[model samples]
Target: MSFNNGGYLETDDALRMLDLLSQASGSDFYMSLESKGKKVAGEIQTLFSDNMEVLEIGGYSYVAEVASAPGSGKGVARGLPLAVVRDCDAATASIASLLYSQDSDLIVNILVFKAGGDNADRQPFFEIELTGGRVSQHAILTGGMPKRPCEIIVFSYRAVEIKSAPQLVSGIRGAVRSAKLVNN
Candidate 1:
């Protein structure tokens, strides 16, 4: 469906659309794109059916798990977290907050992608950050296409058993890619 004359989908309409997508996908795709926290994490875990603890901080959610130590017999704790904010501005702020809350020695690497505009062919704006020690990664992407008004942020704590950050990002991309409109 096209946006209203305002060139944007109304909040209610967006929420309704999210609900429909969530129901159809049986994943928290809607919540992952709407809210930012445990709700999103819970929805994501549903897709993989991997049991993990959900943790929330500063409007972001994470999947906490234990991973095997590289070449070791022990296990290490990690987190797979995500945040879905409204826009790029919010995403930036969220990133800043996340940095402040973490250790000062943390090193963050951010990469952004924005080529197309608002057209259907436009690629969603995307940013990915790998935190220090490769312990965690944070990613943010514009909802794009049918849900152009929102941004999705995802986090992946590198764990041996858990999916990598890029892999988790691909899952979110898959959810958005599968969205379709049907005429009644």
Candidate 2:
């Protein structure tokens, strides 16, 4: 159940662990982190224009970019949409590409911060859980997440959904297809 001499789980090992955990089929959930700060908005736009593989999760779309320096706790991010897409429940949708750190180890969590209310640390709109350790913890849910935009000012995110994994890849694929327009 290890990849290298470090004994860290590799693809094969990870799968084996999942098989044992009975959570093989992961969930495809996401966090919509919202922000109106000029600095945050500008950064998201710049990052999106730079990336080629735009990760379209459901009605949401995002691109991952790296933070300029180390220990910044900041990184590439997403911006609010100019218009609403069908099936996109929330009005203000922003995904945050955050650089996380645990025990001096760096990690990343791309979340979707929704809009509404006035609290900044309110509950989430969705929960995205990953069996593999990416965004801390095993399950993330939206039970306690508040329905406000200001509640998500910063602090990146942490999924609360109780699922194996958020199937965002497939969801992104669907989003891309839905984005396709007809030449009238």
| Top candidate when judged by lDDT against the true structure | 1
Which stretches of model 2 miss by more than 4 angstroms? Answer: 1-7, 16-28, 31-184
Candidate 2: C-alpha lDDT: 0.25
Writing each residue's lDDT as its tens digit, candidate 2 over 63-128 gives: 223434677777544221111111122222322232133211212223332333223333323433
lDDT of 2 at 104: 14
Candidate 1 lDDT, tens digit per residue, 62-157? 334467858988765554443333333433554435544543223222211122222222222232233321212233333433344333333332
Error of 2 at 9 (Å): 2.8
Backbone clash pairs in model 2 (N, Cα, C under 3 Å; residues 3+ apart or in different chains), count: 31
TM-score of every candidate: 0.24, 0.18
TM-score of 2: 0.18
**In every candidate, how many clashes are there?**
3, 31
Model 2 poorest ten-residue lDDT run = 175-184
